[model samples]
Target: PEQAEVREIPAYIIRLQDEDIVAYSRVCPKGCRYLNYIPEPRKCSHCNTQRGRDLCCCGFAVDNPVLKCPKCWSIFDLARKGQILCGRAPRPPVEFKLDLDGESIVIASLQERIW
Candidate 1:
């Protein structure tokens, strides 16, 4: 049987939400096209210690709603398999970052801001 042509969507555009919690796609500091969003503060996957929580595309801590993964360099989604191909080889493992800033702030109010 012929394989069906699958349409591809930007992983960074994926929306992850929970009861009162939501996350958007934040650009990877590494400059990868992939972005991630979590509901709390987290360390960067590349730097392993750098925090990009609630930061904007400028990489600053603001009332931003988009966040990205530090490792796989992917925007955490129900579709992510924890393994992403960058150029050719797979990327290293890393934790995801979340955006939490204020109350009723869909840009940050991810239930509770993670530092």
Candidate 2:
């Protein structure tokens, strides 16, 4: 069978093991891609750092439950509405309200002011 083409979505959806769904913007607040690679424990492909560097994206781990920006090393909590755990980002990533309709998830509205 032929493989289906993979297209990039405008946002990121994180489904926890408990069936809870959370969504956030793909664009990082620091003007970089939020998650350009498969998130690993304390590993960021963009920063290419193995050591514990605060200025690198090597802290966005699923076990740690945070999303780290590769450019500025901003940390965002995945459980607490993408709250800023730490770093230089002036604001958190824009979150989108989602509604499940039958088999599809719809973007209801923006949770934060864009402007």
Number of the top-ranking candidate, with lDDT as the measure: 2
Q: Give the 10-residue window scoring lowest on summed lDDT in candidate 1.
A: 103-112
lDDT for model 2 comes to: 0.65
TM-score per candidate, chains pooled: 0.22, 0.66
The sequence of per-residue lDDT tens digits that candidate 2 reaches over residues 49-108 is: 435453564444455456667676677776777777667787888888989767667667
**Per-model C-alpha RMSD:** 15.4, 4.7
RMSD of 2: 4.7
TM-score of model 2 (CA atoms): 0.66
User: In terms of TM-score, how similar is model 1 to the real structure?
Assistant: 0.22
> lDDT per prediction?
0.34, 0.65
Error of 1 at 8 (Å): 2.8
Whole-structure CA lDDT of model 1: 0.34
Clashing pairs in 2: none
Can you write out model 1's per-residue Cα lDDT over 1-115, one digit (the tens) per residue?
0143323422232233433332332444355555545433233333343453333222323222334454433333323322333322233223333343342222322222232
